[model samples]
Target: MELSHEYLTENREYKDYKDFVANCKLTKPENFNFAYDIVDRYAELAPEKRALVWIDDFDDEKIFTFTDISRESKRAAAWLKSKGIKKGDTVMLVLRRRYEWWILMPALHRIGAIVIPATDQLLQSDFEYRTNAADVKMIISYDNPHVQTEIEKAKVNSPSVQYLVTVGPDREGWVSFHGEYEKCEADFPRPEGEEKTYNDDPMLLYFTSGTSGYPKMVLQDFTYPIGHIMTAKYWHGVVDDGLHLTIAETGWAKSTWGKLYGQWICGTALFVYDMNMLKPDKMLQMIAKYGLTTFCAPPTVYRFLVRQDLSKYDLSLCQRFSTAGEALNGEVFNKWFEKTGKKIYEGYGQTESTIICGNFKDYSEIRPGSMGLPNPLYDVEVLDPDGKPVPRGEIGELCIHVEKERPIGLLMGYHKNKELTDAAFEGGVYHTGDNVTQDEDGYVWFVGRKDDIIKSSGYRISPFEVESVLQKHPAVMECAVTGVEDPKRGMAVKASIVLSQDYVDRDPKEMEVEISTFARENTAMYKVPRIYEFLKELPKTISGKIRRIAIREKDNKKEDK
Candidate 1:
């Protein structure tokens, strides 16, 4: 399959990319399964092709061929079925990038079960909510004692949960997944009923990072894998038959974005680094040691990488780099571009969708801060609250045109929440709840989320813009800006900040004055944070996203007292 020049061009409008994106004329098969179509098909065509390369903190490494994956998944499917797992059964996975997760995911798909990926960082409360809300039946997790304790506590409340399966080591009460897999037949046939599933059958469920309330379940169908062909091939510039590493745990959606579906579909060998904890230098060393060709990570990781000396590592093999979790700061972008000639291609999406916006590989013009344009298959726009199109350079809610039909990559709906789903499309647009401004040149720049916006003294302020400015300060390591209640100004901009180790003991009041003065100098005075609180670290979600809501709640409680 030749790459489409039209779909790969940068700065092109949706119309230009649309012609080529949907032109391939691959008809949707009635009972399509990714494990069957993409993985097994590739295994049949190229049996010896390397599909996965994995290493752990203990320097243990293993390589899996396409044939190996296909065979193991069959065994896993047989084992799961023998345990009474069936079609549409919800199985929660908390395997943190273990090699077994790679096999289990496809096996679940082969059985037509919905795979819910969760991080091991989940606390007892998080497990209780997700297990009950999703009616999860079985849990397959790593043999970590902390996670085991949480699962045991949550099991009392999660009535739907019936089985506890542990990988790696045996727990007293839990079933040993590794032991069961060894005993299962390797050539067990795929269930006959799997042939009845269509392209629209729900295959994956992801819980949104609960920054506001309980996390909403975002469901994606089997067709979701088809959507990421662009993500792996173009956005990440994944080279066929080369090693690609994306730094993310299995619990996050990014794992699928880089590790599983798209990379294999593109014929690239996925690289997994299963570490107990992240060490920037150790990660750099792994890249050099493994000869990794393409790399992708969140902006927060890049920020830390920039602080380290680039010359210490031999990163010549790394040709492509990409970022997603949050918008890339211009400072990190420029520094990385300077160190490596390769530009960091920034893509945008949520747990609800695939890569919807990106700076593609074929594009020559790379904007430092723009999130590129809307993906070709998606009819995206920036609309005001009234559903009217906002003019260029004006901030508005980012929406996709649902009247035309939701794209293949989009979530089916907020699972089991019709009110939220209907509200999302009530105005004839799929509201992203994110604010953005498109430039005259057609690149979109992210503004703060609608709720994250601060209204102080009649002026609306974007927390991202303010936070970006604060990040540029030498003293600041990380920060989250939120609106706090204020009688005088409706809402006040409050910054909860973590200073660099060098500045930790320094007087916070003095640092606050400096940050305030710096913001006033760089941006409008109204946008400057009215109050600053210094901390050793900002509270973050399990996925490593800073939780502004937690800070806001703390401030509100303080004000009430």
Candidate 2:
């Protein structure tokens, strides 16, 4: 029997998609804690089973068993507790894909403290804002020169910060993580009474990318991981005794979605490659070398992979492939499937929730450019401006039903911001702010975000649709589509493109016309970009998502000039 059967109603597998939607249910255990209930339990039962397979750029490797993880986490918990880190205290972790993160995450969870994962690319300003806003009592960092300096600079003004712990070699004014943990006794019993965590207690906090405004804290309780059972076992198609590789850093929520919770609960081993930089060829080599069975990555990674000679690598062992973060383009999807003989299953979700919709292995038919069907966990619907569900073939805001009961994995609220929380759940449902259209067959197709839609003449154009068409062209390496100021039409479609290396030196005027004609031929005339600007790179957030709002802001400044 699968390990997840303990938490799920019955066998997670279903004969068909309809069966899953109709019968799937999760049994939420009261006072649930994944660290003790799952990790420790696995250690006690199957101590020798592989839990993590880690590798670094230096070719160094470390394989951890469930028993090893339990021991290391216990030691870490003892070390942290010695420093006065207790229940309800907030701690920030900036260890990027490091093995110690695997140790510290459970350690934090076991202690009932909240874990906030952050990227190492943050600047001093970003650090200041996060530390102050979250009241971060302690920060466990990986010693990158820039990151360490920024943290020091931010610490002067951050009154809540009482401890600075670094993971590498010891430095003055910093407590060495390994140094402290090695000396601590590996015995941390689970807390009792008021100290124990419940199903509704906050376990994780994520700061949004701030694409539109200042970052808001997204808080999720201990029950969050239970929701991703659909993500790994079903949508990602993680197999029994499989070694799954999800290309994401521990800093982001995507790590929890793929690298940690769901995969572990299903008794699958995680393959982690701690690379200094992401090169397509290197990534392919790791997959082949490790004999990884299931894989998931964003559209950007697939786009890079499709450009390389895929036949050179032996990826025969990797049977399942999936993509998320952004919608998978038709061109990339087709090329990958043609080369590898596997379809790229697309899933849709956000930091606020788990996989709300996906192309599961059993039920959903693979639509080339669609987000597939909604997951059984969420009552997904496309609602219009007036909060009425739209017809099958029309576009509207995607919302989840929550008036009856908020789903297990869904966020509690934006931490300390009741006004923002109320606005998000103003209606009986929780608004996703993403716009999509559902076909008669129940397949959901992504239109751009609510703010991203462009009104040109009388047509509402989806930036994703135009971007999909442009991505098919060889000259366009990357692109962000947005609406620009046009006095007559009110808004005209504009594309900011990053040219491929082969076409980077070509005449801008000639390439612009060539790309424009290609897009016009492939897509609707109305959806074709009226204005094109070629740049070295498109503006993106720290997490590598395109910032369309930044592009529009720059265009507005130019219009004023």
Candidate 3:
């Protein structure tokens, strides 16, 4: 039986999306710890059930069962306790796609430690800020030379960090995680009384991608995993006893969304491909080789996959597909569906919440660019500035109703910043800071962020619509659309484009005209970019999200000059 059944209603299967919304219910336990309740329970029930299937670019493999996970996590818990790591302590893990990440995550949960999974691409300044802000007690990271040097530099000023552990070869001062943990006995037991974790106790912390300002810490309590039952079982469509893969590095929140909690609870073995670099061909080859049954990735990944000669790959084994992290372009979705005979279910979410809306399996009609229906877990709405719901088919800010009670999956406010928290949760709702519209069918369409919308001559333009049209053009590879200051109009729609490799040598002026023409023909004339600039690459956050705010800031500086 699927472990998710323990948290969900007795009628686990639903007739349709509406049936799901009405019948699906989550039973939240008072002292629910995922490590003890889910992982260990699976270990006891089916000890040999495959839990993880880890592989690397070099063709190395590591497979673990529920028993292995249970035993190793206990050993890891022992090793951590030996280092004085205890309940409520913040421990950052910068192990990107390393199998050790799988071990440490549950171990930290077992000890009631708050785990902050960070990207390996962070430099000294990023490390310094995060460590100080979270008051991190320990850090266990993969041994990348640059990351090692930066962490060492940051440690000088980050007095909160007491222990440094490395997953790779032994460094001078860093403790070897595998070396020490393997020697420890797996005898750590669940804590009793106040030492135990509760439903409301914080379990995870994720630093937002800081598109506008400094990254705010988003914290989730123990009940967070309970919310993702909808994400894994419905949205991603992970089949029980199948191998599921979500293409994401361990550092980001996407890992948790698909890689950990819900997938395990659904009895699906996780397939982790630790690729040092993302090559489309290799990714397809891995999927075919492993026969992964379910898959989820960002729209950017699908955009690249669609560009590949997909006919050469056998993706028949991977049945379900979904995407998030950024808005999905209609062209990309159509192309992918055409090639694979499957629709890519688009989901919308943030570091602060689980899947807010998604094209769930067996229900959603799979609108190409729509963000699908709102998840039944929260009262999702498109609201005006005063908190009233806007009429259907009108644009407004996407907000979640929290007037009566905060939902399970939503974050426990920004860590240590009550001012920002209160501002966000004011008016009895959690403002998503994203602007969108809902059709009569209740499918939500992403316009842009509150700041990302481009206004010109009394017309509001969605950068996403413009970018979707541009993406359909052959010359375009990736693009960021933003509003630039204009003397005539308050803000002009500007597009920064990275040309496709095939069109790299094309004439810039001619290519711009072709792309602009394509956009004008497909979308409203006002939505087309007034200014176009071609570049080799667009500025991006470490997680590979295009930084439109960075483009807007550069344009603002130019206007000031």
Candidate 4:
């Protein structure tokens, strides 16, 4: 029996959520390693099974098999071992969607060495902070002029690094990874004695692409991927042999959410669009070309898709679509639905845990703008600051209560910051810094980032709620709502918008008044923006979340608003 079956005790096709969550139980085996038990197991059972279908920016295509990955990872593990990356040693791979990421990451896991998957887009300062923060001993990266220059610059300040490796080209002072793997033996034995790993051993660390403050290092145990079964099967609706695509860079936790872990475990062939930048036309072409059965991306991608001539694309084969990273706009949801007749499902979680809530099939009805139900594996609630459960109509912080049962995918801790970790896990509850309201039907509506809430004349406002209304206007493409410094209300509702291309030439004052009027008509009076700023683009984190703090800072320094 497979690991999924071993862990997922009964009811694979569960429909009623209350009954499904009530019976959901994972059987934890004593010493389970994903690379060996899952990856190699598939290689043994079905060696020729397709693992990855990759396309590059140049329109080049390549395919890989489970056998190829298993062999490559073993060889890579041996080569990494030869380079002195042993158990518990930290190795950061800056290989963005390059197929090498698939091989090297699992290879790191097989040897029990800690893996930190960073993006190739890191600057020198970013690299220095990550390397020193994680005590990374080795760095494997995609070789490019900028990336190469930054790594060399960071290495001067990053003294923990003992070896430098590159994947593509032969460079001086760097081990050519592909060249070394070819020469190394295809079999690597697991380290003996102290090298053995428990299911709870730290296997992965992700630096949260945060909006405010320094990035927090999120640590997840070896069993982390098991939790994403909820992500792939239930939320993404992935099927074996079908192609599934989730847009994410290797550095982010979303890659493991889509590309690796659950998709592979569920036997889905992952579609990787390894490109320098995202293009709406390119993604649509890939969908039609690959016959992608299931797909997930951030709402911004959907916003761009809705901008294109969507009617020209043939995407009938795609069974389900999902979005995360930020709240899905109601207008984007409605437009895509009108074009494709498919409602974009929403999921919510963070680097610290797997899918906490989602619009899973049959388990929850399609509530166009809702984040669906909490995953059956975890106990989710909206709690007040005092830790008491908030009423259905009220807004509160979203939290996962682990007192009764600590689910399989919860983060181990903040790697080295016990203070932040303890504060997050206070009262046996992990408080997600998201504000939300629960409806009578238990569907959760995202309000806004916890810190981005606006208090206007004693009326608390949700920026997300206001933006959802703004998105309904034809002129609005993407928008961010943040509180501006107000002398009377303490904070005033301000809208920073990126207008749709068609509306660009329109007069700014007219467009603003129209959008402002639209919001006033649709939402509560206090939620309407008192000030509107038109922009070419909104400032966003690498993960695609709007940098509201940046918007707020710019709003603060203004004298006569």
Candidate 5:
């Protein structure tokens, strides 16, 4: 089944990518609840149209039509409302890529409640921090033992979370999600008058994996999805009646950037793979198994993919491939191109915004490592320290100017943190905190992050947090953490340590393993250091500052054995 929706609302016509960016306009409706405006509309128009095709490790499959989604979400909404959940309340979802997430998220939007999508990998302390920070009222989670145990333990500190709803099988003190959904009424009526959601209503809340401090809460209005028209239609090269697979967790912002909004609006069937772990061979098999048409993932996935025997699978069904979350490495792009005869297109954006820059198909030529031109919907520029546009070939921060108006689909601001929100949106511009350089040809090359943040396996990590954990050891005097170049992870966290006098004489190999274990126990798996270097002293600049850049430069220049 195919659906028809124009790529643009205001400027509904464009000849090329250049024309789209220069003359783009958005038509924001007064009360634009995506759940009713898009999802239900699809159900009314094309009830039997496939919205999602889901698969799991057990080879269990589920396909949902627009009518099914519309029905299930209404029931889910009625069930949630009966639990005393109201508009403006925050509900956290840790469904772990389960099919239930698609239904439950729309349910929250229908009720005008703020939906917080969280990863299943979070520990007890992570649960405590996020729950308390957002004043989360209820938590709907997967039935995994680890998740249940962690939340049960975290509740002692999170007094505000009043409800615990578990999906898949009953737990002792939790509501069975499926049982309740089956019993709840399928008719959910819209709120009347002022109680109804508006275009500027905060519908989505995302916790950004910050590079330096604790994760910040990103608040997005209901119209955020409207900005991704270019992302799917032009940048990702998605077509109507096509199958699109974006390799991202349900928690991360990238999922919505590719999975939900733009793809559905373009009438493409979304593909979801619920994997216990990421395996390149298994993923390649799925592409052939399902005959996926368009695919997108982080560069790390491609790095591992290129190392596999791709000749065994038939990938001709795929018409386009894209990479985001980080810059595409030239080697991986070249290797994949040579093997599969497909060029990996690159795009750029952050948690606070949708696709800011991308090599939009039909507009710009693909430059292996460059982020394509700014999307016409956003006024993006490479600004130097003074906040002025930088000359070509010069490095600058990627900033989005909101002088005309706050771009549709951009985050409203950091929730409950006016200081941070003001600082980022200072001068009527949103700073992306990423550095890049552009050539005269208008292609932007990513230089690095302006702060000490690590991009590994598509997760943004804080160097400060990892270094703080390393310093907790009694045997450590001082330590510095930086990202080391890696083909698989984009960059691996490397720690150079100065052991205390008593621990200096200890066996180096034995100490290495001990420290590694210590790091794993104290920090998240993604933030743990992979490479350890024992140093008598860390390199310091004239101002007595640790030269972390020196460490990164040294690692980049190191010849692989």
Candidate 6:
């Protein structure tokens, strides 16, 4: 089927991208399952089409056809059912980029269970919270002793967890997932009347990064996969039957953004790189080795990639580049563009929704730092404090208009927290809690989080602007900007910085002086950080977002002491 531009606007209230976004028509179906509608449908039509291309750090490689994935996932579904997993049961998957994540996810969908993709980097406390909050029934994890040890400790506090299934080598007291699958029939029958699942049935639950407090569960229904059609096909420009690589562990929401749902729905081969550690040079080498066609990663990864010389490897095969998770600075964006002649198309979305704003393929005009236009499918708008629409070019809260009803891509509300959900939609619009400004031409530029915006001496400042300036400095490697409590100014701009390794041996006071001087010259004097803390590393959430709240809290505690 040839996808038309109308597919992006099908059943939507808005005529085109120009209408002041309001009352979007959300698409719903009687029985909607991505595995059936997208994946399995493609499998039936093109059984031998390449579905996934996987490679590990050790250079091991494998390619799975749609038929292979369909068959293996059926066996996995049977195996999971035998282990007592059922509909609505939550299963935590801690496989980092393993091909098994692909098999197991579809398997969970086939069995009508909820899959919670989690990172193996979780500490015991993190594990405890997620397990308790979600009432996780089983944990399917890698056999790494370090992660296994944390799971063992978390089990003591999580009584609802009934099984530990290991993906790799056998671990004591843990069931071998591979071994169990080997015994199961490859052609297992689907559950009785399984085809009757509605579009609203919960298929996945993602725990927010918890930068503020304990993570909130974000539940997405079966139709969530349909929403990502714009994500991979339009925004990422994924090519059919070509490999697309998104640098994310299987745990994070970015995996869904790039790996399984959208890419498979587009008939593109998903690339999985199971690496033990992130080495920018090694990753580039792998891209060359595997002939990666399209790539997406966070700004953090791009920061590291730009530092390495580009002439050392062949990136000619890569056709499209995209970024999300956090704001991308103009410096890194320009550098990558200079090297590869490929502009990194910035996209904006949250754990709560699919790609809401992005630089689409048809939009040839690339703004260096803009987050592009609001996605055609979503009724997005910039609103002021009173929930009124703000004038164009004015900064305001980013909100999704859900007057017709929440879209399929949007979360079903904070799981079990109606109060929070109501608060989020109190103004009749789904407030994203992010502050941004729309240009006269309609491109949305990220300012900062509403809470992260610094109010100093009656002036509002975006931390991202300061961080963007700081990133241009040669001595700086990474930085997080936050507001520190100030009696005179209400709040003072503070920068917690990590210097490059070459500058580590330099005197701390001297390094601070250099950074402050660079900031003063590069940006407005009032925007420059008044207080600076040189650190070995900035605190980050599991998904790699710098936790400015943690830094603010630590600063506050020190003052109290």
The clash count for each model shown is 0, 0, 0, 0, 2, 0
Query: Which digits, one per residue and each the tens of the lDDT, describe model 5 over residues 451-536?
Result: 65688999877565576677667576667789987889998999999886778999988889999999999889999999999999
Better of 2 and 4 by TM-score: 2
Cα lDDT tens digits, model 6, 1-561, are: 212122344432244444423433335456666665665666788888888888887788898998888888888988988899888899999998889999999989987899999998899999999999999999999878999999999999999999999999998999999988979997655456753467788999999896797788899998898788778877898887788999999899999998988788777888888888899999899889878889999998999898899899999998988999888989999999898787898999998999989887755467877888887678889999999999998889999999898876888888878998898888778889899999888889999888899999998999998999999997888999999999999999999989887888999899888899989998988899999889988998888888888998999999999
Q: How are the candidates ranked when ordered by TM-score, highest leading? A: 2, 3, 4, 6, 1, 5
Per-residue lDDT of candidate 3, residues 1-561 (tens digit): 578888876545778878878877788988888889888998999988999999888889999998899999999999999999999999999999999898899999999999999999999999999999999999999989899999999999999999899999999889999899999999889998877888899999999886877899999999999888889988999988899999899888999999999899888999999999889899999889899999998988888889999989888988898899889988898888788888898998888999999998877578889999989888998999888889999999999999899998999999999999999898999999999999998999999888888889899888888889889997888999999988899999899999988999999999888888888888887788989999889998776788899999898899889
Estimate the Cα RMSD of every predicted model relative to the unseen true structure.
2.9, 0.9, 1.0, 1.6, 10.2, 2.8
TM-score of 5: 0.82
- lDDT at 409 for candidate 2? 84
lDDT of 6: 0.85
| Per-candidate TM-score against the hidden true structure | 0.94, 0.99, 0.99, 0.97, 0.82, 0.95
Model 3 global lDDT (CA atoms, 0 to 1): 0.90
lDDT of 1 by residue, 1-561 (tens): 212222233323234433435542223456668787777877888889899998998989999998899999988988998898888999999999899999999999988999999999898889999999999999999988999899999999999998999996888889999899878886755457544567788999999886888889999998887778778876898887889999999999988898887787777899999998878899999888889999999998888887888789989998889999888878778888898666899998888888878887755367877788777667789999899999999989889887967777788998999999999888777888889999987788888677777889998887888888888887888889899888899998888889987899988888989889988899887888888999888888777777887888898899889
lDDT of each: 0.84, 0.91, 0.90, 0.87, 0.83, 0.85
4 or 6, which is superior by TM-score?
4
Better of 2 and 3 by lDDT: 2
Highest lDDT scorer = 2
- In model 3, the runs with Cα more than 4 Å from the true position are none
User: Candidate 2 lDDT, tens digit per residue, 1-561?
Assistant: 247888778774687889988998888888888889888998999889899999999999999999999999999999999999998899999999999999999999999999999999888899999999999999999978788989999999999999999999898899999987999998999999988888889999999885788888999999998888889998888876789999988877899999999999888999999999889999999999999999999998898888899999999999899999888889999999899888999999989999988998858579899999998889999999999989998999999999899997889999999999998898889988899999998999999889999999989999999999999999888899999978888899999999988999999999989999998888888899989999998888777788999999999999889
Distance from true position, residue 514, model 3, in Å?
1.5
